[model samples]
Target: MRVKSPESLIAESGADLEGHGLKRTMGLFQLVCFGVGAIVGTGIFVGLSDTVAEAGPAVLVSFVLAGITCVFTAFSFAELGGAIPVSGSSYSFAYATLGERVAFLVGWCLLLEYGVSVSAVAVGWSQYLNELLDSLFGWQLPAALSAGPSDGGVVNLPAVVVLLMAATLLVRGVRESARATTAMAVLKIGILVAFCAIAFTAFQDHNLTPFLANGVGGVTSGASLAFFSYIGFDAITTAGEEVRDPRRNIPIAIMICIGVVTLLYCAVAVAAIGALGADAVGDKPAALSLVVDDVTHSTVGGGIIAFGAVVAIASVVLAVMYGQTRILMSMSRDGLIPRVFERVSPKTSTPVRGTWIVAVVFAVPAAFSSLDAVVNLTTIGTLAIMVAVNVSVVALRRSHPGLKRSFRVPLYPLSPVLGVAFCLYLIWGTGWTTWVQFAVFLAVGVLVYGVYGRKNSRLGATPRTGAAAEAARGA
Candidate 1:
């Protein structure tokens, strides 16, 4: 139950003089690209069809509301990330303000969010890979080789292949990873712009007649689903120790990433709807490609879109996998997990072993099992962690009134309170099955903490050492 002090956390973050810690090489541009790389992935690329079906042409409004919902929690993240600036992201933030047990549980939740997200993205990546390959080569991988067990296949080979490829890039070094990710981020953004330009060329005013097909209720529900599209932006905080001047850059990157993603999302929604009537876009997979195919009437335009999806999704896996390694590294440093997770390579200045370990752990599931159900855990876990972060802001404000926060959550209690409320509402929207699954996951986390984390926690060990030193002096 011991809470780490902010001073010690900050001290450890700066003691990175040599190869002992993550190298501080990323600036605001890299940070923003890192975030955009993670955020603009398969979700927006392929899942827009369902969202559009729910909200009609008004999916644009859904995207805006979803972005607004994320802003509430983003404010809290900006505040604490600026103040603490640790590699652990919210897990470290929770440790200093919420206590070790809470921190462990939060870390456990992050493991679900990042770990499962990678696998889920991999599964989706396989679909796009098949699309791009079929477009270019007139052939696709066999169903048995490309599908998971649930989908009636031996293993998802392409999924495993992509995950390993991402792992390979990550172990190289954060700078190398950053450059690759930044280039991909820019390329993907250009692709989206190209998509908008093409879709707009065929704009039909009559297709957008009933913008609000089902009124406010449909937009609300669509926003609930679209909210998940913005999940990867908070990943910016995971690079805290690795970012150059994090306090200034982290907040700026987050806000900028969110704004850019939101605008792109809205623009794409409008373009797709303007090109094809809302009814035509109803629940088709890869809706962007569908819009382009309808207008250009050729497999070539759709093929280009598929290629964009390929790069977009791959960038997501690379960036999000990076976040997962850093989160585990933070937990390992606190002695809440195995020390192997924290060991960074002196040569590369990255957690090579841990990065590969994470990739292997998630890659197996991506290959053998379908993530249709398990993926829901990520939504529940992400919401739960965001709730803790929102509450941590209030608790930290009260606990250490004088702490230096470069950016404070504006509107104080109301802002974070709304953040908590929105997150809990989304959690409930996931339904009882997900709640039960998350409950089971939490029980397992508690068992792990009791058996290992509590006994080995560095914070819990501190007082014992202090008391032993005092007793020796007395004797």
Candidate 2:
């Protein structure tokens, strides 16, 4: 149970993780866009239908609940991201406070979060692309090209293309990627706002009647699904190394992104419900666009929203994949995985090799895997990681009480404790099948760690406890 020291991680922070180090081109604005970019995609554009299917109009409340749940864990992430400011994010936090083994497992779980989540967002992008095409020209790609096997298609070519597009942007450099994300984030927000405005004009009280269409059980289930929409806020922490003045910027950016996104999501839910009624909004793909179509009685209006969704989900693919690459880059530096992933392209200062590998690996599944499976897996995995992050905050507080923290959890232990409880409560709402999937993923992670990770881990060469204590005291 030897842990890496937080002081050491902070001291060794930049450039050394990967040769040439990542370029710190991101400021507060770009960093906030990164979080909004990763989070604002997919979940609201396409998955809103599914969440509404579960919770009805009460899905609006579900957004608030999920946001509150994430707020608790986010307080912990803000504290650690500021104090540590590394690319490994929760994985690095766990290594500093928990131990090597826990770090490995936490990183493994992160793959399910960022990696699978990117794939899910890509698939959502494909659906929106189809929506846009049909709206503009009354035509779309054939099912064989546009859909996955389960959806009665040979392949989801659009999903693969969008994933690669994001990978290419990421490979070029972080600044370019951040610029693209920021522009897209602004565009998508405008589109959603516009949709809300139009839908409000036609708001009908009857549409929102019987708000709890499915009852309390449905609202709980919907909150679990809505949780996916807020999934990417933690991604702000993933860019710790790439952001300027990370200590102050990371926490501020995370809070701003969540506040903006939550307000927007709740507004969108209310507008869509009021405009189209619960039944119309639920179980319908491209649900927002459909509502605009109904309210305006024009396909062109829907087409505009569809176009925005395409851009929105594409940004998620770009942003989330960036986060995934950095996570692996951090893990590789620790020798928990091959060093190839750790190698930075000196020219671009990006993990080019790992970025492509992540895109290709996730692309295959996005082409054929079911969206529900990927979304559920990502949600559960993220919840587990949040639990670890909250615990790490508590552990680090006790382990290094003198550690300088720019921000601290407001209520001490109670906030993190509640964070854990809220996460577990949501997990309880998830189906047993998702739990089984997570267990299997964990078992595989353990096997990989026991085999290659344990032997090659950088810490294996050091007397961990003594060195860790010295490093802690050095702070």
Candidate 3:
């Protein structure tokens, strides 16, 4: 297997972006909005309940732990993204520093990360939509049509519908999608602020008395789950090809997105626990909406929170679906996947076919599968990807010492080392079942790479011997 050099990858990516008709219209603020939109969705609205169950009121500490780990990884991403602004995000960085084989595996893991995440978020949106409808109109979708088999329903029609809608928005254009995402992000943040205000009114000091009811181990476990909320900010890196002045914009946007979302997540966690208590929040599907109702003593408050959740999850589906298609497009261009996925529509300047393909694949599982299992799979895949990215930074620093990096990771190897260690620590907390599932997924990825990717890789077409070959081998 031939390794694609960093210089080669960057040149090819520039040509691919133009040849594939992807527009470079996203600015720093818009990119930051995309990250915020993706990062602050289902994780806060739905996953918080699961975190609360794991660590009780101490879920706040879980949020902090997850945020710190993500911050370290984010710095690595910013540095690499600035140096090699491409659509594949970590996959591209890995290709430049690791090898085609490693890059292919990274891309496969991302398929699981972004693809399944979109589906999971869509499912969460369906639940919140049902809550909103029932609150405002006094009627809900029939369970047979609204939920998956695991949730005692035949098909999650709402989930499928939301996925299709998000795909449609993406097929239109990135600018339009960014605008929509920004609007939704503002709306959701506003709702969260309102929720905090109301919840504080009902805050009971005793609710936080047994904050560490589940112990330090529980807080660590909760952080493992909370890590899911931090997953989507990296999706912004996937938009490297679409952003203007990517070198400067990518790093700035990543830091801003992480900082803003971490603050919001911590505040929301505190308010929710303070108002309704962790026990009440635990196991509830739409915990934010429940907290709103309990705090304000009105169905109207719940309805508002439910509506915010509907918009929040939609933004997540949009950003994640966009990231998935772009990653596939990058892979397809490198001949790792079928070329059909690389085709871009002249009219829309978007990969319409690949977008729909992802939509169908995402929608089906979401229509019939359970959320917890899929979420667990997504978190593990993401952790693996994060580890690869952090390592890529360390490797690139040594291999390409003179490369013009617009942003450098602070503290050099220390940042990336901590990033890897933190990611592995969270992975350990994910338990045996998640590890088994991740191993199975990677096994399938290896089979695919051996059977198809290695044979078809564009890089392997060129021969590199002597020092260049040695460099490729080192990479």
Number of the top-ranking candidate, with TM-score as the measure: 3
Candidate 2 lDDT over residue span 1-475, tens digit each: 5567776676656656554878789999889888899899889999999999999989988889899999999999999999899999999999998888989999999998899888888888999999999999999999899888888899999999999888899999998999999999999999999999999999999998798889988988999999999998988998988899998999898888888999999999999999888898886978999999988999999999999999999998888898888889888888899998998899998889999999899999899976876888889999999999999999889878998888889998999999999999888778899999899999999999999999998867666456566753543
Q: Candidate 3: which stretches are off by over 4 Å? A: 465-470
State the lDDT of candidate 1 residue by residue for 296-401, as single tens digits: 9987988999999999999999999999998998888888899898888888988889999999999988998764545567878888999999989998898778
List, residue by residue over 9-77, the lDDT tens digit for candidate 3. Answer: 677767654365678999888898899888888999999999999999899899999999999999999
TM-score of 1: 0.94
Error of 2 at 278 (Å): 0.8
The order by descending TM-score is: 3, 2, 1
Clashes of each: 0, 1, 0
Worst 10 residues of 3 by lDDT: 12-21
Off by over 4 Å in 1: 16-19, 212-217, 464-475
TM-score of 3: 0.98
lDDT of 1 at 353: 91
> In order, what lDDT does every prediction score?
0.86, 0.89, 0.90
lDDT of 2: 0.89
Supply the global lDDT for candidate 3. 0.90
